[model samples]
Target: MRAFVAIVPPEPAHADLDAFVAPRRALDSPWRWTPAHLWHVTLAFMAEVPESGIDEMVEEVAVVADSCDPIPLRLKGAGMFPHAGDARVMWTDVRPTDPRGLGDLERLALRTRSACSRIGVPTAGGDYRPHLTLARSRRAVDATSWLDAMEAYSGPAWLAQEVTVFVSRANRSGRPHYEAEARLPLGRR
Candidate 1:
């Protein structure tokens, strides 16, 4: 199964982003916007795992979650992968509102990835930048205008109290559908 660990933003935050993007959706572009229900800050992308490994993955993630405190995060600003001139992916930045939030999130991500590695799941290679992916373009698109439009967005802050392991399956339309397999609460929560 395809799986990943992520922090799903609360409904209010989603609503804030939805309101901001609603007006821009009509614009004709090569970008494929992500569905609102799929918005999440990915901590670790464990591309594939055997069904038997699911329990082990959950246990490892739960241990990491218990060791960390809840993080306060908000969606603000935007940028493109590679660059706006020839960008394939577009995302909104996820920032910690609290002074210690970034550090905490970083630690959480590191631990999550480590756990997946220990369980024999291959992890995504790259420095972890906390962001909620907004769209993807099949070919390089001029995302400068879209980036400019997203600059003014700053959504409501919410506590990320749990790390969820989501199973990804392709729908009939070939779009990925994420289902929460396990939700592990952080710290004492």
Candidate 2:
């Protein structure tokens, strides 16, 4: 199974972002925009794991979830991956609305990654910058204008209380669809 661990924003956050992006869709850029419903902050990307590993993966994630409390996060600002000049992906930055939430989020991410590692799940090792991907480009495109437009966007704050393991399935149109296989509640709430 192709799966990943992520934090799904609440409905209010999604609505706020969707409303903001609706007008910008007229830009007609060659970017393939991601559907708002599929937006998530990915913690660890486990490309392909055997179905037999699902049970162990869920248990590991639950342990990490139970160790942390809900995190308050907001979708704010915009940026591009690999720099703006040669950008491959466009995303909206996600950060804790509360001052202390930043450290909590960082720790949660680390704990989640550790849990995945303990279960022998291959993880994408590197710095984890929390962001919800907005779009992707097949080739490098200048995103200065798009970035500028999104600069003033600040969505509603929502509490992230669960870590979800999502199974990714490829569609006929080449776009990927994600289905939540397991949702482990933080602090067991």
Candidate 3:
């Protein structure tokens, strides 16, 4: 099964992002708006895990969750991938601007990757860049007005206290549907 580990956004943050992106979606460009409930920050993509590996993943997540504290995330800025013209994924950027600044979450991902490797699961290909995926555009949106609107949007700080392992399955629409296979909650340290 296709799987990935991610930080589920808090409710307020999700709602805020939905409102922030609403105007941008009105632009005369092709873009698929992500469902509000599905917004999250991906930490690692564990591809094609065997059915037998599910238990191991749960165990690893428990260990990591127990060892770490929750991360306070701040949402800031909007950005496009592959430059402004030939864009593919549009997202809202997030960073740990607090004193600890996502340090705990970073360490947990490293640990999760090492643990997953033992079970023959491959992790994400590149360095972790935390962002909330807003849309997958069918065509490049080069509208200056839309870009300006996105640039002016901002959201408040939110808490990330749980790491969820999601099973991504393609639905009848061919769009991916994510189900939380398991979640590990991080209480205050």
The top-ranked prediction according to TM-score is 1
Q: Candidate 1, residue 13: CA error in Å?
A: 0.3
Over 79-114, each residue of candidate 3 has an lDDT whose tens digit, in order, gives 787656667777778777587866766777787777
The TM-score values for the models, in the order shown, are 0.94, 0.93, 0.87
Per-residue lDDT of 67-164 in model 2, one digit per residue for the tens? 89999999999999988888889999998888988788888888878888787887775998888999999999988888888888999889998989
Report lDDT (Cα) of residue 181, candidate 1: 93
- Off-target runs (Cα >4 Å) in candidate 1 are 169-176
lDDT order of candidates, top first: 1, 2, 3
Report the lDDT of model 2 for residue 176: 80
Error of 2 at 158 (Å): 1.2
lDDT of 2: 0.87
CA lDDT of every candidate: 0.91, 0.87, 0.77
Reference-based lDDT, residue 109, model 1? 97
Measured with C-alpha atoms, the lDDT of residue 70 in candidate 3 is 80
